[model samples]
Structures are given as structure tokens and as C-alpha cells.
Target: MNKKQWQGWGPDEQAEQHYLVQPRALAGGGDVRHVSAFLRASGWRDKSKKDGPLLMESPDRTVRVAYDPCILPGGWTIHGRAGDATVEWSAHLGRQTPVEIVAGLTDALTRPRSAHAPNVWAPLQEQNWHTRFADQNYTATSPDGAAWMQYRQDADGAAMWWTGAKDEQGNGWTAHFTPNTPMHLVQAFSTELAGPDPVMRPRGRVPHSAQIRTWSVSVKPSQLSAWQQARITAARAATWARTSARSTRPRTTARPYNPAGGARTRH
Candidate 1:
């Protein structure tokens, strides 16, 4: 009987890795070859055969990205690290082309850095606040459920006012602070809803809207078992080295050679 093949990274190598990006498909329909090509073009190295996951990494060995070609259309995942911080985010491939999906994910991960406060909320806060918003339209709460922030949109304009306090049972108060609310208050409201350094949430585009869309912010835990983190780090470094070697090598362009050694004069 044939043996079942191992589908994941080696047991000894899984520790050092932290996923930077994880792309998923709604029902599993994406071409892995395209994913590989995209990574190579973007300066990542391909370390495995064409049939395996298109694993690659940055030239500096700080970031790694990959997707399993044999996993059907389930999705793709990219892992990256900077300093002591590690980040992972994923999205469903949906109906978009693989190039588009990968580009979007790459752009989100590689874009310029901005100065922002670190997220103080825990993962539970990040998940619970959004869930609550779906049920209650004008209510916001901290991760611990100890504080509440509420807002209401104006009936005539794109204006909102928010109040933060102990709970929802306080005396009702309203204010018209449109167009210029305090930054600290805004940050407080944002921190309560989305974690620190929030990326824009992914919502399908609005019809006929020309506004520039924002990248969704989905952060993952940085803490990992030592062995698991090491495995990922090693994989990324190895993949990067392989691709860098190929990219830096000189290419010889093939020219049609004449059978005769002598050059023929144009007739």
C-alpha cells in the first residue's frame, strides 16, 4: 500500500514561524502557480518544486510568504516578522483573480509604516466588540465589557457623536460635535471597537462609490512556542536564500545560431 504524504512543515521546523498573511477561498478555486510567480516577481525566493507550496521570503529574511499548491483552492498563507513583532492576517479569495488577491495582501503587508499607538485590547476585545456592533447599531464596549461608548449618526449628514462612560444606565446626553471631535476621544472610541494600529475592516465596496478603500486590519498573537517559531524562521530564511540566488544569477539570452560558422550576408 502507498503511504500518505506529510502535508505540513516538518515537526522540527514548525516552531519559529509566524504567519504574515493567510488568504482563503470561498469554496477553493485559485491557481497556486500564479501565486508562486507573483512571489518571485515581488522579490521572494521559491524554494520548493512547482507542485509544492509557493514558499518564498524577503531578501532580508525578515518576512516569509507561502501557499500550498496541492491544497486545492482552500486559501493561501504568508508569514513574516519584523524585530520582535510578528503579524498574520487572512482574507477569502472570493471571485477575484489570484494576482489581484495576492497583490492586495502583499501591498497591505509591505506598505509604508505609520506612527500609531500599540493596541492595548486583547484578542477577545478585538473579536467581541465587532460582534456586538452587528447586534446593537449605536453601542460600543471595551474588551473587558467594563466600559461602554455610544454614538449616533446625524439624521441629515455624515456626522457622529460618541460618549464614553462606565455603563449604559447613565443619564442620557447628546452633543453636536460634528466635523471636529477631539482626537483623544476618537482614539478612545477606536480603541474600544478595533484594537490599536487598526487596519480598515474589509467590507464589499459600495455601489458607484469612488472613495479609496482601506486595507482591513486583522492582527494575530505574537506569542508562539519556541520550536514552532524557530521552524517558521528557518523556512523563511532558506526560501529567501534560494530565490535570492536565482534572481542574482546572470541570464544568457538564447539567440538562433547559424549552422555555418561564417556569418551570411543579407540578400
Candidate 2:
């Protein structure tokens, strides 16, 4: 970083004051690569302030802005750092692609039964790969349960990948992730949709959940003691269930059939 001196309210100010400007010429020419510039504001207000801009100079030598938004609540925002003190921050807003279904689950609607009104939705099934909206978790579903959506990956698959799991009844669940760009469009109410595909959830965020059978515990016993214990427990439960079932039946006698002495009918 280089520094210079300027006078007055700004560089244009008639008053004489010292100001600083660090400028660079675009390297590799237009055919090769574009150029960039960094500026530090000084003297006009306080002694030390810094600003940066990534620029693509005009072929005709005019100023053109590609994409730049400051630390505010608008598009492409960067926020949450006063001066870097090990603080955590996030950059996301509420934008979604709305879907209404009686039973289907997606990245959007996975929460309490009371969350979705029965008029439009059935209860969330565990088989779906979705979980409820957490406070720190930025996800959404409308009041009537008609509209629902999630802030999916804004970047291409080349940069990042989203992994997820489904509940027993197929409710979808996504682990929390950070935004690539400082702030991204949350895809609220409106969805940028593609053509048809069948697994029922959005093609972009859908993850295939392996069919996990609980009986694996019995199949892959970790220890000799565990296998023996499972067998004993299962045997006891089966015997108890059988006894309980038999006690509920009416008392009856078995007819003697082909006994050593003779075949005898019940009295």
C-alpha cells in the first residue's frame, strides 16, 4: 500500500491538504487479464480508513462496475466485522421456492406437527431428509403451511457440495452451512425452477438416504457377549408373548391321537 497527501473535503477540494491514492495499471493487457484497484480514504475525516474495489477497466478507458455492494442489507453484502475480534457472523436472507404438499417433505418443511396445518399437510415423516427450523438455522415455511422453502447452495457444484439426511418417514434434514459470497439471495417465495424429475424433492438439494435397517444390530454383532445377550433377551420376550397369548385363549383339551395304548377322543 502506498500513501500520498491531499487537501480539503475530498480530492476535488480547493483547500490544500495531504491525501493518499494507491493506483495500479491493468496487467497482461485486455487479451490476457483485467486489472484491479485499492483505495484508502484519509485526511478528509479521520487519519486511517481503507476501502477496496475489484475493477475491470473499459476497453475505451471508461469506468465500469461489475459487481460490488458494501456492508449493508442489499445485494452481495459483506457484514459483521467491526475490526476482527474472533466474532462469528452470517450472510443470508429469507428467499425461497414455495411448495405445498400433503405428505411430501423437502429441505424446507421439517418441524413440529403444529407447524403445518392439516388442511394442506400431513404430519412430517421421519423418512424424509428434513428437520425443523432452528433459531440460528435460516429456513422457512408459511403459516397456513402452504408455502415452504430453504436457502439452498447459491454456488455451483464445482465450488461446494451439500450433504443431507432423511428421517424415518422421509422428512429432509440439512446440516447448517455458510454462504460462499457474503450474502446470497435466500430464494424467498419464488423459486428458479428447472424441468421435471421424480424423487419429489427439489433436484438441486435432494440426497439419497441409504435404507438403514435397524435389524443390523442383530446381524452384525459387535461382541460375543452382545450376541449371547441378544439371543437370551429375544428368547425371553418370545416366551412371554407366547404365554400371554395362550392365557387369553379358552381352556381346551387335546384329543389323544394314536397313544401307545389306543387312540382316545376327548371326553
Candidate 3:
């Protein structure tokens, strides 16, 4: 049969295609709870259609958030649209899904109406040190190959040294150390390259009686790269300003709030 004739005669095929394309209904999942909570807190009104996909409308009705639970593997497909921008994504209920729908809807509803007004700032853009560290790739390793470190300077001129090592269980531990001075960074690199070896304790009362073997680490003057020297220089000029301020701040005792719209101070 020709294509048109075959399509006209196939009721089962049409039904199958419709079901495959439609969003499946989700009974219970993390997405439902999170989305529901977000909607209620954000003042979004539910305008879902009967026996249709779940739908939420922003308070001003400028944005719409839709979820179809029929999408498999990923529990649901969330689609959000505001003005000329539209975003759609699918993720399983338990997974760390990019639920940008919440942000988009919130922005659309609360944003300033004026075109000249400044845009709303997003807190996610201000990533912490840990987040920045996770994005870095360590290009250098210690001489013993047990430790790795990365150096990064942020756009705001903040700099940090990230060091990490793996434990016996293959789990990793990391630390951020701010160099007190340029010499401090030099000493850190030197120690990593040629640090002292572990010494055994004397078994007898006379420590001098026991013979201990020792080895020296040799590093040529040319071995220190120019980049390393630059880092050392920067470290020397850098001070732990935050640490100093925190240490010098006076401690205060917090008091309970008074219903009279005033806070009671103990000190």
C-alpha cells in the first residue's frame, strides 16, 4: 500500500505513536515533592488541566512551568518559558536535575518592569573556593607522587593553593593553605620536592648508640621554574587579611528579639 493509504488504515500505529510522544504520569517521585514545594513557596498557582500534564502558572501569569511524568528513565520533563526564552530539561526524580524552571519563573514574576533597571543578581554566580577548586586541574605533583597541588588566581585578584592526597581507601582529602609570604610558598615547594625522611625511634636508653641511616635531597638552582618564582613573589606580598580580621573581631552575645520591634543587647 502507498504511504498515505497505509497511514489511514493504521489505528493501532497512530495510538502507539501518540502514547510514545506523550508525557507519562508520575505517581510518586522526588521531582514531584520538590516542584510542588517550589510552586507553593514561590506563590505559583496550579492551573493544571483535567487528566492532562501538570501545569503551574506564576502569580502574574507571565511564566508557565509544565511537567510530564511520562518521560522514562528520567522521571519527568520540565518545560519553562518566559517572554522569548524557553528552557526544557529531563532528569530522574532522585538525580541532581537542573530545575531551572524555578529560577526562570521567579525571575519572570518578580523582575523589574523597567527596561533600564538593573538585572537581578543570581547567587549561583558567586561560587565559593571549594567550587572553584573542584573545577581546577592539577598540573603539578609532588616528588614522591603522593600529593598534588593547584594554584589559581580569581578574577577578583584572590589567589589560593589547593593541595590534595588520596587515602588508603582511595578516598581523597583536600586542603587550602594561604602562604604567609613568598618564602612560605618557596619552602612549601622545596619541602614537597625534597623533604626530610621519616626517622626511627631509638630502642635503647642511649639514643646515640643506635646507628641511623639518612639521605639528602638534591635540587639544582636551575630546577626552580620562573612560574614557581613568580608564585613565590606573589605569596610574599599577599597577607591573610581575612584571617587577621576574623581573629581581631570582638565577640558578641546574641539576645532574643523583643516583640516591641527592638533587639535586647546583653553587652
Best by lDDT: 1
Could you tell me which residue pairs clash in candidate 3?
23-70, 24-69, 24-70, 182-236
Against the true structure, candidate 3 reaches a TM-score of: 0.25
Tell me the tens digit of each residue's lDDT in model 2 across 164-263: 2233444333222243321211121022111111212211222223332111111121233354455445444654675678699876987446858775
Whole-structure CA lDDT of model 2: 0.25
> Which parts of model 1 have CA positions greater than 4 angstroms off?
1-34, 86-98, 114-132, 135-267
**For model 1, what is the alpha-carbon lDDT of residue 103?**
46
State the C-alpha lDDT per candidate: 0.39, 0.25, 0.36
The runs of at least 3 residues in candidate 2 whose Cα sits more than 4 Å from the true structure, single-residue gaps closed, are 1-138, 142-167, 170-176, 180-267
- Please give, for residues 198-253, the per-residue lDDT of candidate 1 as tens digits: 22212232111122123434332233334335544554565577678879999798
Highest TM-score against the true fold, candidate = 1
Report the backbone clash tally of model 3: 4
**In candidate 2, residue 237 scores what lDDT?**
60
Model 3 agreement with the true structure over 100-198: per-residue lDDT tens digits: 222222233322343443211111122111222343432354333443445666767576554444423433334343432122222223232222333
Q: Which ten residues in a row have the lowest lDDT in candidate 2?
A: 20-29
* Best of the two (1, 3) by lDDT: 1
